[model samples]
Target: MASSNTTLAEASNITTMAGRSNSTEAASPYSFHFGMLLNPDYLLVEAQVIFSALSIIWLGAHASLRRPPSAAHAKPKNGKKKVKDVQFAEGFTASDAIMLPVTAAIVLVGLYYALEWFKDPDIVNRVLRIYLSTVSIASLGAAAGHGLDIITSLVFPGLWVDRKGTLYRVDSDHQHQVKVGEGDVETEVVEIKTPFPSFLSTLPLSHGKIQAAWEIRNLLTEEWTVRLAAHGLGLAEFSIKLNTLLGFLIAISTTIAYNTTKWFFLPNLLGSAACYSSFSLMSPTSFSIGSAILVGLFFYDIIMVFYTPYMITVAKKIDAPIKLVFNTGRGVSMLGLGDIVVPGMLMAMALRFDLHQFYHKQMKLEPIDLVSELATATPGETVMVSETQYRRVKPTYADPEGQWGNRFWTTKLGSLSPVSIATSVRAATAFPKPYFYASMLGYFAGMLVTLTMLLVFNHGQPALLYLVPGVTGSLWLTALARGELKDMYGYTEDGSMDVEDVIVEVDSTGKTIEAVKSTAEEKGETKDNKTGKEAVARTEKGEGDYDVFLFSVTAPRRRAPKRD
Candidate 1:
């Protein structure tokens, strides 16, 4: 009877202990399911980093490939021709560098106070959703276009055709001088009359026919006869190319899916598109400007993250596509867009510097004489004056003759057909990118450090604090080790040091027909027009008693012009 009682007592004690253990686990914050513990959150985090890095690098490479804005000109219209270039965003100025941190502080403080006052983020999110969604559509559309271009270039290089044409103002009916003959049978000059002033003809080539079914008077004043295979597929005014239309459709569909489902991957995809678009639309113009921006933001990030609760609070509460969020088993990890874009601008500038250096090393400038007619005080007579200038030999990439295909299929492996693997390898490894590679390595290391700190402290960390030093330090160190500090400092996107503009007219036969000169007196200009500095002009009698005005002045440090 005593043994039986002891057994019952022991069983009660065991049951009580089990119940206590279950209650403790239920109350603990760290309690998680077995499956949650086994979840591969680290892999997802690594993917986020890789995706961000690739997006930045791709943007930087393409930015380097873009031609100077001045090279592209709109076709002449209505008997008038004007030089116009589109600038997406202004380059960062010194004042902007100074004001960035201050502005961020103000904005963060406002957001924190507002959130505290409301005690609910739903109102703020609703308002932000309206604004951010609109922006996402535009940004995603542009990103889609870029993606289409890249994919087509890699997969369908043969489909691309390069067409050359001249632009002219149509004041009246136009004529073209053409040589008509068979082979070497003594070709005779023939004049062809046409309604348009300029047309480009590729012999024995006609992929499609141009139909002038309807014209919109003033809107259809300019004409382009270039035979590009990728033409529009709709009405003249509302026309969009096939590739462009497809890209827009994809963007729209993705956006709709995101709004409807609100899935995790959708936000990530949209966020990446936004980052790519930002890189495309904005630039730092020079290495110095980029450096200044990065350094300023470094301090801003440190203070907002460590000193105040606003950074983490604002990030968590904000329900927008501005941040990339990864769900870990414990909670969620967030990376802000500013973390990617700010340092990315600097990295992009570094890539451009690499390309600039490559061109400088490979290409040589050829001197050419520009002759212009200057009328003297005596009417009905003019004298010719010639000025010497230099023009750079075009790069191989700029050549339109089978160069695009060559970019992909240059190296052949024994007995292997030209494959897409070559495109990926060549795109990444073809460029000499000491600075870019260094920055990229630094960014990866910084990311690892940030993640480590987050795991150690179990707190939100300022990414830029690590990233800025990593990116900027690596670049500067590489430049120092290579003994290219002088070159690095000298390189700039500012056009102040570039050659002065000269207007030269050429015939279809590639002969210089006329050169136009604008005199300072005619324009009534006593100052340097571009730099807005003081100027002094001196006239001297040249050969044949022609007046030649020589301007000697200092070029002021003007704002760097922006370009895409």
Candidate 2:
């Protein structure tokens, strides 16, 4: 009887242990080893460090940009010489664009070889940790490099070399014009030239100014084509690509470091120290995970949504008109949201210990009451709480139904809400159905492929890698490109082709836009002057407005004479 009781007790103990193991497996996003090794305390410390370092970098960059250049790359004092040199530097040199992609490819390839040692599981898991201690110091070096590059750009602003070999500069007043030529020879400066308005007025009845407009229009078209040929649309696109490459590089480096050595804590210690010491004063706790990981993601978003359009606006500030703010907002809403959603979903999956949890949560939260109740603002226009104070007064207004303006209403209404209504209308009447369907399919397919690959490998969480270029990267590429067409470039909120809807182009000589009917007639592109060129028509107020233009030329073009 005693022997039988012992056997039963053993069986019960084994079952209990098995159940706990299964529960833990279901809860952890990554492998058990990762959970055990990664100290949350260290992550918190690292986060604080990263934020501090980033703050210092930004502060230093701003200060250096504001001050006069004392560095070797500083502008020359004399106006003519400064312009000449600046133009030379800004113009697209042969090595500038080519080197970016070539260098990235080469680095990635080299890293792959260097990390062959990681193929050995023993070196990677047990011994490599020691080597990371030394190489982690290089992160500070990378931060320094990034800082220098930014300051250099700010100090020597608008030194862009075009394919036509021209240098343009932005003055204090924000006007952009060609500042430098091939050499220092100064041509006779014409203070009063043929005004653009006067040129427009002089067009003949037949093609009007189409011939004249073609001169500038052709160049503008070609420049954009060439930019695309370079495999990216703009600086924002370039940044995205480059940052991806940087992330891979960091991953490879860390992988190699971990594989080659056993004691990696030294580098972590130094990296954490540098990250914290530089950033702790002002930076947030999110930046120190790695030099490239946090900043790269944030920078990519900022570049795509804000910086890229702003640059285009600056390049064509004078002659062509484009709405920077609207374009920015659109980029943020569509592209930014799409990009972030993948990673965010992954994070949600990690939290729930199952990738399906993201979808489940979406479905679960659909009918729930999402509410936020705010107390009335005090008399002094200051909102004070237990641990925080604010100056802005909260609005008391709610929706027409007397409910708070929380996003829950939108979820509850589903397709009946304004956003869904607009999307449905676009699908029904305006947006190309096949194209929309194709893009949606591609996005979903990409996400599935990414998730499958991660599950197959049994590595880290998959969501973090979804935005990454690999198989997952291609998914976002199509979505972003399509979204740009469907969201950018169309009409204003009022459904008019205002100056804000224009696409501006700039090169070595000047700025230009697609020739309007009046100007295209002068440029000789359109032979009939009596009829205006047909602008792409847009749908009603609710339908989406996006203008994705494909340029045909290899270089930028500008108007010969400034229009009055």
Candidate 3:
């Protein structure tokens, strides 16, 4: 297989030669056109197409991964999952079906515009505006993805959740700790105020306690004021400020990438290569590179649409230490915009200077010269190529049509030769790890074949045969990556927790009810100052209120598999 370095080295030589040839003399009929490579519009068109594909794949991934929970108790009355009619946890609710894709679309738009404006938005007077817009788009995409997950868990109560029925006693903490009896501990109830509910209710992926509070506030606005005023209230203002910072970073990097490069092909390739290179510099790991590329690609497509909203939601829900959770899940030092920058710049330069034709010329290839070549071959042309053209185009030693060269093309066959079958069979048998490893092998084989064709064409004909690999590989890999993520994280409709269940208690002291439940009316009579002592004593002697609610939740028993 040809390494990127080899292809690049060859490309450099081609560039030098093409430059000399183009300048020294008049253009030859066989000379390649360099202008096609520099077309900025192609870059934009490619980006749009790929991003559009990503939006579809993301929707597909959502449908595949966070599948609706089973309706064991709440039957699908309308013969469907009734996604909008379901509610599972305290803070989660059934979101509109349109809401899911809309979130993704928003992210997509953000990415599109981010690439458009931020790519070159000079950091002058309105730097903040550019920054804000960029951050907003990225945050929206992140938030939408996460929010959709939260909503999915909410609507499909049967989805993964761990700690249910967990009880927390606020008043008990304040209860006087006094030894009541032998070998027993009791609290002296000096002030019998109703115990505030426990801080935690639902089991969030991270920062369950704090997130529970925000989730309650966001989804249950009616209970927000009361819930916030309850115990567990601390610093809210600072948290918002922190979230804005995260949004800022995400936005800025996205803008830089968009403004720097017209197309993502090189960025995707190089970022993926570098990502895999980290796992084993000498031996690239497919999953590492593939996941990085796929995730970035999906995230890239959704960047403009969902990243910001998702970031807001994540920032809110991440009531835990921002540094920790961010570093752990989404913010882990995974490949970011920086990884794409170098490649993006390389592509920009290549496009700006029409470098591809140089690479082709260096390899002895010709350029696509006419509109006819751009279109699919006509039936007559196809027949001619399949029959008479083969003899003329044979590498060498073609005497009439009955020779060895004629024999090679006499039998009608697809582009693939017998070597393809042999290579495929060998690749399948060579991998012992998983089917994906086999897939990686197949992908490499396909790339090798394509590269070989590019080399041969550049050496001989030089027509643009690159059309084959570019379109096929991009779409194929995108679909494959989405499918893999779905298979790994997807839920089933058979009411079962694939992971372990965490049992938490729910009693009078727990916040589960108060977080979502409404209030009741109470009446009392008051007298004058003469009854001050009596009133104070009565108020101090208030009884602690407690209620119990119990249910089960499924939490991950072990670290979930990230990649294969």
Candidate 4:
């Protein structure tokens, strides 16, 4: 450690005329790590530390906001039933963390080597490059429009359907254990209905916009086209065709124009918007999956980037729009889509978790703890809770900042005595929420580290290698220092209660319904997806609204309730 620190300090020296002219310059491996005014090496280090520290602050605020509506230890009267808290998703389990990474590694190996095997196919590579570029451009456009999609879904009523009708899951099948004195809680079905005026009057022209666009499209179809052609009205038909074709032509022309830049400022700016959307929507159900992906990619990044120059070679040769490219006057600099995307996954997750936290606060409810069933756990005792069995049950507590604390401890000591291990037992930790914000801060810190590494190495560095530590280090350290490590480590998500009736992207592999295809002439039609056979159009709402409804209609299920 001391030697490494010395190396870093030595690297921080600015390249000067005196140093450059020195006779000993020939022996140096690098010009400078960070010779700039701030010394980026230290700056990068400080970013990791400071951002993580900020996360802890937000973690405390989020935790306090999410404090269970009812005190955990609150007492109940004799006849009172158990108050079941809402169960959201669980954190990653130990096995999942391991398995996900292994799978990703296998996949990455296949992709990397396949490119090498097909490296000689000049024609095939060209075809793929063009195709990928097109997709990237389109995705960028879609991403740019995604925010608008959400906004339109609001004004354009039929764009989204609240099948569950914004109902709340005050309780779910995955029960949160609130102590019961003696009797069962009143299981009488609780019906909650919320109505809001997202009505036509709010935005009067939303209907007009849809109607106008529809009319314009219909003018080019057989109904209008044939009528004009049959009457020998070639001029009218030609005018209509030209008008319709103009928009289509422009869209294509714009894509080609963007591609022709050979990666200038616009491509990077546009591509980033798409990348951001993709990252934000991916919620991590398991830290196991997130960890596996991050760690495996960490080594993969280093190997492909540094051990060999394969990654650099691919980026240079591909000529596809798979990365963000910038024209720095002298030349181009690039950041792969993965660099923006992978870390963004966690950043996005943080945002989602934040929204989730906000939902609890807005509703005046407690953030659900799914592991409440095992509330009373001891370090040395193995408790079978639910289908999952925890090997060691430790006392539940939070860090001093009142955040989810790590609670994992080693049971067996070899040089380690039983129950007396010297090293810390690294375990997975999860929190109800607010904890996710810390991870986000850590992500920013990691990104800075990645940038600093790029500057120092004067080549590519696998971002995850830096990021996994930046995000996880802060989470683990803050949690560990507060003596809440175990609680932080053992977090789980019961994804069964995830939001059901949200918009789906037809282009992406998500369960959300983009659109349901059905013939209005057919009766009692249905669409079977991964979930099961679901009715395409509810009979009552009928054909007109079905065309606009973006969410899938499945059998009634528990959902995380929403606030108006």
Choose the strongest candidate by TM-score: 1
Q: Write the per-residue lDDT of candidate 2 for residues 378-462, one digit (tens) a residue.
A: 5545433432111111111111111111111112232332223222212212222232233234434443443343224332222
Candidate 1, 1-564: lDDT as tens digits: 001111100010000000111334335553323342233655465456556655665664454344331222224544443432335375777677778778877877787788788899888777666667667877777667656655543432321111121111111221222331222122333332222212222233232221121111111222222222222321122223345556678878887787678677887777777777776577777778788878888888877777877776676566777666555443344567777778877787777677556545654445578799999889999999998654444333231222243343333434232233333223333547788888888887777676555434434567787888888889888999999998787766664323323344555664545534335424546333533322212112222322133223222222332221
TM for every model, in the order presented, reads 0.60, 0.20, 0.20, 0.43
Q: What's the true lDDT of residue 241 in model 4?
A: 35
For lDDT, the strongest prediction is 1
Tell me the RMSD of model 4 versus the true structure: 20.1
* Candidate 3 lDDT by residue in tens digits, 1-564: 112112111110001001111222223333335553343543343233334322322222222221122111122432433222222122111232234335545643453354455554233214433443343454333433333434422332110111241111122223211212222123232221221121223334344544343333233211111111222332121112222334345435555654455443323322222222221111111223332333333333234213333322222222110111101111111112222221122112112112112221222112222222332455544321221110001011101101112112211244222122122211211212233223333333432343333233322111112222332243345436656433322322222321111122234543222111111101112233337556556645874432233233222122221221
User: TM-score rank, highest first?
Assistant: 1, 4, 3, 2
Q: By summed lDDT, which 10 consecutive residues of candidate 3 come out lowest?
A: 9-18
Better of 2 and 3 by lDDT: 2
Put down candidate 4 lDDT per residue, 460-559, tens digits, no spaces. 4565677777775665665667575544344324443222112223224422234222233133232223212333334233533323212222222324
Q: Looking at model 1, report the run of 10 residues with the lowest lDDT sum.
A: 9-18
lDDT score at residue 177, model 3, on the 0-100 scale: 15
The whole-model lDDT of each prediction reads 0.53, 0.27, 0.26, 0.38
Superior candidate under TM-score, 2 versus 4:
4
Tell how far residue 498 is off in model 1, in angstroms. 3.9
- Those runs of model 2 whose alpha carbons end farther than 4 Å from true positions after fitting are 1-80, 83-459, 462-464, 468-564
Judged by TM-score relative to the true structure, which candidate is superior, 1 or 4?
Answer: 1
